[model samples]
Target: MTGKRATQLALLGVVILLVAGLVTGAIGAAITGRDPLLPTPGIHLAPQLITGEARGETTKEVFSTDFVLTNTILSSLITSVLLVGLFWLGTSRLKVVPGRLQSMLELIVEGLLGFMESVIGAARSRSLLPLIATIFLFVLFNAWLGLIPIYQSFGITRWTDLSLTELSKAHVTDVKGKPTITVEDLKHVVEAREAAAISASGKSEAAVEKEAHKFAETNRIEITDAGTIGKQLVVDGNPVTVEGQRYAGKAAEKIQEAGGKVKTAQAGLSAAFLRPAGTDFNMPLALAIISFFFIEILGLRALGLGYLSKFNFIGSLLRFKLIDAFVRFLELVSELVRLLSFTFRLFGNMAAGEILVLLSAFLVPFVITDIVYGLELFVGLIQAVVFAGLTIVFAAVAVAGHEEEGHTAAPEHKQPEHGGGHS
Candidate 1:
């Protein structure tokens, strides 16, 4: 076949798939009284547990986990390894005629270094290149690598259940001397009812008790294989059989109650084994803190003790210049405020991007999601640049000497002259 013919055939296939996806996706499923081709993906703000025992069943239990290993951590590790491996490959062998890998690496570094020199001097930019470049690469790769299909396609299934024995122990008598369960206690009440149902259905006392004990325990969560994730779902420990594309949630529950093993939810619900580190608040906050530390360090190096004077309200207050003292205080607050601004800016954008992609896939499937993915690639690059570029800019401002408006401009700091530089 000719290349042009092959291209035309590929396009035709794509168009057909797009049409079929729309017909079977969320909208079409709703109209047809059938399960959607894709289940509604759940949104989670906090990073999901990969290997840890939470205090409770929900994400709120995250705070109390014993040595939690979250999906975001896995993602960061993978990103780090990828970066290290690529750099190693590029520099491990020297070539007068550069290979593609080396050339690509050089292009990125040289472009980033030139940009930095425009903000700070060439010497200073070169000196800080390691920190700034690493930051940019880490953020960029973490965002981009997450776009891979495997990141959230497979992970620990989300499981929740009621515990009757725990509920009974949690009850208390109210002022009216009547037994009443709080709304919070309702989750546990279902276990007792389920146990009785099993007993009525010809299960022996011991068997019923054992089944009851299982319900009284916290929901069992296990990792689903990537190969079977979207196709076969296990709820409460039982593999759910789909009739056509639909699985009934109530029917699954009934099966569990009647002593047939099943898991929670209609379609198997799962948390990803790896999520974009940028989507987690901690990842961005950590980067911001590291950036803040380096900025202050650079300021101190360039200005010595004079740098501390920016926040030195005591001298102004002792001189009874309350206004100047207030301004100094504001400056200090602004410095701290940068941490929050940096954290939320990256976190919000990445999280929102992730949600948009998932929703696009769920609602329209094949065609629209590809477009959204392309947009995300651009967004990821922009966010990485903004984050690293801001770090360099802030460092520059920090090191630049300050002069009072009415006073003679202070002589430029000699520190930057040493190696930091305007040349």
Candidate 2:
């Protein structure tokens, strides 16, 4: 008892010191206006390209067709391999008395089956188990595996002079001497561009002039709406183009490290090769498309030609019942909108969770971020459950006509026992 009590007290002391240190360190940094231990993370809406000549480039928009492959694509492939390997290992060598992996697999399958049976029916649940179960596992694995340290830490590097919008268009390689731009130089260009925009917006000339002066000590430069000042812009007679937004961050870091010039800086970037698949809009959108088709197909299978009546207003039109036709049209619109709803819902949640964990780590590195990671893990499971649960509910609604909503109670049914013969 004495030794255990001593150990407890020691652990308590360590925790106390940790909290105190974090608080004091944060306070000191705030008061002194110092940079946080970790640099502010850049939030990207689009996944970084990992293949093709444009690899390492990222776009501002979530939807882009220019890239061949991205980090998120690789992450999805990894998730697929993991899911296949895991189930294969669990089922390949089953015994009468199951091993740990087999037991875990059974537990997961049984729980999912029970959940589905509650929503739809025992027979229907068993029939649709493969689709719903695969989605849940895929999403869950993608989220959980992303938390591994290497997913965020290891990746290709980005250089300062490279084209931000499309790496294939970068002119540095074609130019002689690789004429380098400084961080200060980029800052002036950005500020000039902003001042021009503000001036064009009919701001007071004096205010625009003052802003321009603060941005640059030389003659005020004007940037066109197309992001170019003029064709005359050149370094050593080679034309140079700059993306102010990209230069505002990682490029700035490189220039600062290179003593204001990217020519001498070692590469420093944080574009991980394996980001979570959920962070990419494409992944969630693909899943939603699959779910949509499955739901419609299941409805058709159950109701036959009658299922078409849900969206078809032609009968009402023939009867001249305008109100009924309009209402059915609304329902049709709502049904189609579910595709976008599913896509954005999952994408937003996963992206937000990723950002939360990243910002927490940047603001307060170790202990606090670990706590956030735990919360994110719970959130991940919740998202997977929500996604899978909603899919089952929708499937039930599709197959059960309009009466499913009015039915308060799911009918009692016997859960099929997993017999030893299967194992």
Candidate 3:
């Protein structure tokens, strides 16, 4: 009785000390103006620059790829690698009496396999195990990485600052070591040219100067109205008149030919090449489309062409009647259903997950987003697995007709080591 009492007292003392330590830490954090409980803000993942055209080069807008691919895809890739590496490391050294690591893996895998076997039965489960395992691992890795603080935000950058309108304007690129005609600078050249022509043609000096000034005030360069300033000034060398804007263009070319200069502004070598994360819809769509296609492929490989029949209704008819003729009749619908199902399934889940995370973050500080962060990770993995698994299941069931492989009787379930069999 005494020993029990003492043990309880000791445990109580330790708990009190732990509480005291926590309180002290909290107090210190408050005093330091640091909210230790808050999640750190992730790096921004938006394109900074839409680089405009340069002189001499074609006026092209370069899509800025500052933080998009680097932060999102790179992290996903890393997570995938780690998952593959860990599973590889653990499984490669398998033994009859598993080590602690292997045992832990076996527990997870065994659970998954058991679940799959029950759903798919022995024959199909064995055949689909490898693909299912790969999907499960890839998904889990993507999900787990999404939960990591570093993955969400780190090592960010901006390439340039350019407005949509300004970015659309053409910048000069063909610098010939001489000043060239720019749209704005055309006014000055027109003013000088019109004044000179008027003076040379014997107009009164005051009238000529007044007309030139009038043109300059409005155009700030040349009198380009009708054929006054914009007209061609030379045929080989003797001056004549033609029509249009760009008086300075002719002069600038002449000046360049007669000893003038130009230059090019190059982007810094450190400029980033990947688009910012979430800035565009292409990445997510690509992810959805690719995963969906793969899923169908998985189903096709597992089940056969017969597997793809009844995603809608055509397959049901073809099953009863072997009319390869009717195949095209319902193909559009079948393909659309399969394609849309895969696309929407992924798009809807990802979009929802994204919006939910954003709302949560907006309501609470980033520091408070740990729960959602983990949720996103789970959602990503589940979506990936569900997508791939469904593909395989549909294909397997479709092609094989749910009964009678070569053998007279079904074999004992050879449950997969992953829960990717059907559901």
In terms of lDDT, the best-performing candidate is 1
Model 1, range 301-326, lDDT digits (tens) per residue?
Answer: 98899888868888988999665666
Clashes, model 3:
34
The order by descending TM-score is: 1, 2, 3
Q: Candidate 2 residues 160-220, lDDT tens each?
A: 3332222222321223424355335554554655465456567899998886676555332
- Relative to the true structure, candidate 3 reaches a TM of 0.46
User: Which lDDT values do the candidates have, in the order given?
Assistant: 0.71, 0.66, 0.48
Candidate number that wins on lDDT, 1 or 2: 1
Ordered by lDDT, highest first, the candidates read: 1, 2, 3
**Candidate 3 regions with alpha-carbon error over 4 angstroms:** 1-71, 159-335, 366-371, 402-423
Local error of candidate 1 at residue 400 (angstroms): 1.5
Candidate 2 residue spans exceeding 4 A from truth: 1-28, 53-67, 158-270, 401-423
Collision count for each candidate, in order? 5, 0, 34
- Please give, for residues 1-423, the per-residue lDDT of candidate 3 as tens digits: 999999999879767655544444434446666543322222222322234323343322344333223334554457667877887888998999999888988886776566567666766667766666666665555555554444443422222333212222322224442234444444454566567656756889899889878766552222111111111222112233221212324454543453333221111112223322222234445554665565567657766775554343455455664333244345546665676676666656655665666545544433334467677777777776686566556545444444644241133222221222443
